[model samples]
Every structure is written in C-alpha cells, then in structure tokens.
Target: MMPMTITEIAEAVGGTVTAPFAGEHAGGVPDGEVARSATSDSRLVGEGGVFVAIKGERVDGHDYVAGLGAKGAAAAIVDHAVSDADVTQIVVDDTVEALGALARHNIERRRADAGKPFTLVALTGSVGKTTTKDLLKSLLSTLDETVAPVGSFNNEIGLPLTALTVNADTRYFVAEMGANHVGEIARLTTIAPPDIAIVLKVGVAHLGEFGSVERIAQAKSEIVRGLLPSGTAVLNADDAHVAAMRSIAPADVVWFGIDPAHADEDALTVRELTTDDMDHPSFTLVAANGDTADVRLAIPGAHNAMNALAASTVAHMLGMPLDDIARVLGEQRRISPHRMAVSTVERDGAVFTLIDDSFNANPDSMRAGLDGLARWGAGRKTQPYRVAVLGAMLELGGDEQGLHRSIGAYAAELGLDRIVAVGSATDAEFDALAGALAEGACTAIASRGGTAAVDWVHDADEADRLVTSIASEHPGTVALLKGSHASGLSTLAERWAPADPARR
Candidate 1:
C-alpha cells in the first residue's frame, strides 16, 4: 500500500488512535511513522505493516493484538483497543470496515500521484471469475507490474485486501468481484472503481440466494454500471443473460465469444476451436479489427476458451498485440486449485487418470467438468473406462433435485462407464439428492438399453473404496471428482493427487 501514517489511517477510517508506545509522541506516533501494508490475519503481519483485528465467528482478532508489536507491526486497527497491547491501536466500530477504508485511501493516493497512476480492471460472474482473473493477471503482467488476488478472494474483505496490495510501481490491478445477493458488487465497486469491467456468463451458481436467474444477471451487471463513462465493458456474447446487460452498460462495450452469429460488428471471435487428448484447446484467436493469431491453451478444459478470450480482449484494449496475448495464454498451464486439474495416480500396481475439479460446483461448472471428462476418454487411443464421482451441488433453489437429476442424465448421455453419486449418509436431505442423481442416470440407461453402471455411495470414504475396486478391475480407468466444497470431495482429491501442480 502507499505509505500512510497512523494518524492518516485513523482519520480515513473515522477511528481514534490510542496507546502510543513509550518512544512514540503524545499525539500518536510521529508524522513519519507509517504502515506499508495491511492484513486481517495477525500471523501474516510483517514489519511496518498494519494489522486489522477482525471479530470472526470463533476467533476474535483483538486477542492477537498483544503480540503484534513483537512481530514488527507498526499498529493495530481494532474494534476495541486491547488494554495491555504495546503497539499503537486505532479503535473503530468495525475492523472490517476500517480495512476497506484503508484500501480506499491507498487507491486514492495512487490515483493522485501523477507519475505513478494505475489502471484497475474489475470482473464478476457466477462460475469463471477466479480462472479469468488468473489468465488476465498473467497477460497484464507482461506489460508492467500487476496485482491480483491469490485465489477466489472476491468477497467484501477479500476485494479490499487485494486492492491494498497496490503501490507506486503497480500499473494494473485486476479486481475479481463476487456476490451472494443484490447490491453486494455495487458496494465493492464503490471501494475500487474499474477503468475496464468484464461481465462473464451469468449462470445459476447462486440461484437460491438471488431467487431467480434475472436477479443473478442484475447482480453481475453492477460492474458495468459501476464503470466510469470513459471506461470499457468487455462482455460475453454467448450468454443471453449476459448479452442482455448491454442495454444497461454505462460505457463503451466490447464483445467476445466463440460464435460468429453472436459477434458484434467488430467483436473478438474464435475459429477451429478443438481440444487435444488432455482436453487442452487449439483455436485461432480473432481480434475485433481482423488481426488473428493461433492459440494453443496449456489449460485442460475447452470451456476455458471464453476465459482466455475475456482476458485477451482486456490485454488488446491495453495495447498488447494478439500474438503476445496468445503466447502468454499458452503458457498458463495450471490455475487456482480444483478447477479442471489433471493428475495420474498409482495404486497397487494400477495407474489411473484423475480429473480433480472438486473445489466447488454449480450446474454450469458441473456440466463443463462432465464434458471435459467425456472428451478426455474419447480422445484416448484404447477407449479408457470413464467414471464420474459426483456429489450434491448446493444452493440451487427449490428445483435442486431436478438439477441434480439433469446432471446425472447428462453423464449417462455422455456414455460414461460408471456414475457414482456421493453424499453424507447422516444427512438425509443431501443423501437423497445423490440418490436422485443416480436414479436419473439409471432411468436414462434403462431407456436407451445401455449397460452403464450407477451407484450411490454414502460418503467420500465409500466413494474411495468403490473407485479403488473399479480401478483394480479396470487399470486404464479415468475418474472425475466434481462437487461443492461441503461434500469433502476436494479433500479426497488432494489425498489422491497430492503432487498435482495446480493445487500448489
């Protein structure tokens, strides 16, 4: 963060500074005393950095303030000052709000510096926010210093912490915005407004929280509405819900998609979109002004083409050539963990392929994972046995069962060798959802006279046993683990694919 004194930070957040150390002045620390960075976790506190003491559900950060000084922290921002803490304390009504205030102050300071101004790009969508951010960060960094969140740090606290990482040398700040309800992104946009906004596909990831798909689209469009008049809006033309957002866009719109039918007069388009045996894509990247380059993605899924195009559009807007954009895209092999990560496991003299996409799942991402698995199996020379070990997808509103059933039917339609539905045995509601998925596949297989097998396991342990049995029987098996984080599938994936580079 741009250096700010304890007095300046307290003033920006409307807080009171108290308990100046023995060597400090009477009115807080000296004017030269400042914090270089900010963090909510006390364990991450560094020398000359400020710590925000947040009160979470179980551990209150205020308890950790006593040890901040020994860790070389400059000061602590707390909701209430710790009595015996040696460090200077800035007391506020809420520590989370104070962190946001400090981040906003840091951004304003960078904008005010004429010699070191940075452009901020903000993006939000239901499924691909993190993946798109990762791709965009690599492309933007080719030009100059770029700051982006480490993972899916797109919520209130996450966005602010990422914004505070910007300093004088930073040229681009990629902000990934996420929301569970209406107006959440609007609140975040207020913290760090974007010079370019990207609106990816609006799916039903949070359908339960927002009540309807229309409401979900409304929430995603806030980024476009939040953009300044001079800014640009990079939109996906493939999704009708996202395409409809153009009507409400507050700035210039740039379209990007795979279909020529959806392309605007001068939109970014793709051709010959094909994937290899590992599901990596080789496509021709077409620019708005007729410039084209061949892009062969190192990432596993063909679905990532949209993500790559979105990132490339922003890079092109920033004056990067199409050839450079394609080259950078081909070099990004692995992204944040559990999103189309591929690995091989050896067990009892048998080797099998494991596609661990169990980080989180919604209907849209679930289908994409299944599609990738199908392509991987089809591309094999020997036609390997494919298995989909899927758990319940959460937060799908009243029709959650129907959605689960559809996913099961989709797996069966893909002709996967086996479908294993997994859920907690103790939780009847979740277990029933898993059963519905298995039942759907069973019915579909029966109707088509297909011999595909289906099973419903009680939990991840049961899934492991069943999968191990199948792998021992079928050595060339390819298995996929896809589900919401609550299902414990990602933990199972980590245990099996511990050496996968994406998880690291």
Candidate 2:
C-alpha cells in the first residue's frame, strides 16, 4: 500500500480531522494518501497514511487506533459517533463506510492516471467463483501478469483489501465477488467494479441468510450493475436464476451453457461435455470465434466444465491462443484448501480414499462433488463400499426438508454402497430416501449424529463423525465427505489423506 495524507483522506470522504498526530509527509510509503493510495499498519505516519478505526460487530478496531498510530499509522479515521477525547481522530459518519469511500476514490484515481483502463473481471456465483477465478487467471496469465483476488476475498472488506493489493503492474485484475443479501454485491461493485462480469450460477446458497433463490439472483445481478457501460457479461444460459437477469444487465451479454442437447445450434458457447461413469466431465471447449480449445479441467464435475468454459469464453474474447489457454488450465486449477481437495489414507493394506468438498455447499455443489467422487472412485471395484457422508444443507428457507430429501433422492439414484446423511434436516431426508430406494444395492442411513450409521443407527451430527467411523473401522472404501463451511468437513478430508495412517 502507498501513503496519503490525513487531510486528503478526510477531504475525499467528507471527514473531519478532530486532532493532529504529527507532520503528514509520506516519503517512502505506497498509496497511503488522501487523493492517493493507502499505506499499511506500520508505514510512516509522517509519510501520510490514513488509519481507519473500524468498529466491528464484536470488536472495535477503534481500540487499536492509538497503537497503530504509535506504529507509524499516519492519521486515524474514526466514526463521528465515537467519542475519543484525548487522541487525534478523523471523524466520519461511519468508519467502515469511509473506508469504502476511500476505495472508490482510489479506484477512480487509478482510472484517471492509467493511460488505458485495464479490464476488470468481477466473478460471482455460489459454486464456482474460486474455480472460475483460477481458470480465468490461468487463461489470462498466458496474456499478461494477472492479479486475482486471493481465495474468497470478495466481500465488502475483502474487495477493498484486494483492491489495495492491486498496483500499476497488474495488467488485469480478476475480482471474485460474493454476496449473501440483496444489497451486498452492489456495495462491493461500487469499489472494484468490473469491465467484464461473470454471474456463474445462483443456487440454494446462503438461503439461510438471504431468504430465497430469486432473492439470491437479484443480489448477484448487482455485479451487472457494477460493470462499465460498454463492458460485457458472460452468463450461464442454463441457470434460471442467471438467465432471468438478462433484463437487468445494462451492457453487452454472452450466454454460455452445457446443453449440446438443445436444438438451438446458434448458441454463444456450447460443447458436448460429459462426465466419466464416476461423474467427472472431460470436454473440448468451443470458444467465441469458431476457435476450439481442448479443455481438460483437473477439477471433477460437469459444473466445472461449465466453469472452464466461462474462463475460456473471456479468454477467447481477449485474443488468448486456444492452445495456451488449454495448456495452463492444469496449472491454474489449484483448488484452495478445503475445497474439493482429494487425498488418500493408507490403513494397513487397505486404501481409504477421501474426497474433501467441505469448504462450502449448496444442492448444486453437493451434487457436483458427488459426481467428482464417483469419477475419482470409478475403477476401484475392490473397495468394499462407495460411501457418502453428507451434512445438512442450510438455508433453503421454508423448504429445507424437501431440499434435503431431494439430495437424498440424488444419493439413492447414484447407487453408492452406503449413504449417511447427517444433521436433523438432511437425516430426515435420508430416512425418506432410504424408505423409497429399492433395497438390494445401497443402504441409506440418516441421523442427527454419526452414531446411527457409525454405531448401529445412533443419531446427531453431520458428515464429520460419519466419515470417522467408516474410515476407522472399514478402511476399504471410497468415501465422499462434504458439508458447508460451518460444519468444518475439511478436517475429515485431511484425516483420510496420505500419511494419516488410514490409507497405509
């Protein structure tokens, strides 16, 4: 981050400096100025960095203002509502809002100074933002040094943090944006707004927070609201939540879908992508200008083939070579920790393979992970069982039970050797599915705990304890462990992976 003056930051956000700490003159700092870039916690205060004393929901950042100032934080930007009598402070209506205002100003200044405005790709969706970002970064890297938002840092605070991470050297910035409400994405767009926006697919995500699917779509369209007037959008033509948003997009739009099954031959992007018998889709990607790229996504699931296509579509538009885009995809498909990361465990002579898709989940992603598990475990017939340990899918609003049952039905249709649906809602659905599924091939066990499947049908818990018992006792099975972030299923994925003693 750079250096900026207290007065300059105050003026930009319509804030007032209530007191003075020291002389404001940034010499060695980065964009830590009022009309300039932001500095860091330890940057020279004399080098002019603005200190935002944010009041978090639980912890007040204002409490650390003096400590930060002592560490060379230039000026303190605080809330007018905060009554700090002795120390120097810049008063704003809301400190967090002021920080956002600072981000917008810095973004605008960057635009003004650049000889050419670099393209911004704002990506958002439930299942594939990080994967999409990885794919996009891979394709774009072939063209130039690209900077993408690290991990899932796409929220209000994260967006600014990501923006500050971007400097003049970044030829392209791929901002991964996320939202759980109607107005959240809109607020994020006001900062790292995009030149091209991709709304991947809205699923039963954050239903626990935002209320409904339609409302989720409405929230995601705020990305469209953030695009430049002449910018373009790449959308999932198959998603009703995404498709219905065309009317709201004020820019050019390109539709991408996985349906080669459709009779319409004139689609923007379409390919005959298919998953393996275990459900990993490998397909060639046909780009915009009749150019075809052989896309082999290391990430399983047909949904990711869709994700790869979304990345390639933008790459095609940007003039990336078809071959370069395909070659680097393997390097780019690095799924961050806890997100569909596959590993193995060696317990005695048995091979305990675990597929960890625990970072987050909705029905769409849960299904996708199941497909991946099937693909990775396709040829392992010697493994005693194909087990699925699934936690409850939260926030389906009023239809949580039905949603869980539907997931169970999907599990039943998959013909796994044993299925354990954990948590109350999903357990009920698993029971419903168990009763409905023909007996002979698969067993469906639903419980609020792992003991039910783990201990002759004990109830309580998500996939956590379910996988534990399955792997510990019967080390000869392919296990698919999944749950939302709240359930912390990544730990289980690690437990089954190599060197953990299970797969020894």
Highest-scoring model, TM-score: 1
Give the root-mean-square deviation of each candidate in angstroms: 2.0, 5.7
Candidate lDDT scores, in order, read: 0.87, 0.65
- Give TM-scores for every candidate, taking all chains together and pairing residue i with residue i: 0.96, 0.80
Residues 1-504 of candidate 2 have per-residue lDDT tens digits of 323466666776788766534334222222433323443232333333455666667877666555443444456667752343233466888767777777776666556656655778898998799888877887887788687876787777777766765555667888898987789898888887788899899887888788877788888888987788887877788887887777877777877787744213323455667665444556776654566766566665667777887887787778777777777764553566666655565544455666667777788887887666655545655534677777656665676666666666566555566666544343564343223222211223332212122211223333445555566777566677776655434455555556542211
Residue-level lDDT of model 1, residues 235-336, one tens digit each, is: 999989888888887868889998988888657789999998778888998876788999998888889998998998889888899999999998997788
User: By summed lDDT, which 10 consecutive residues of candidate 2 come out lowest?
Assistant: 447-456
TM-score result, candidate 1: 0.96
Return model 1's CA RMSD, one decimal: 2.0
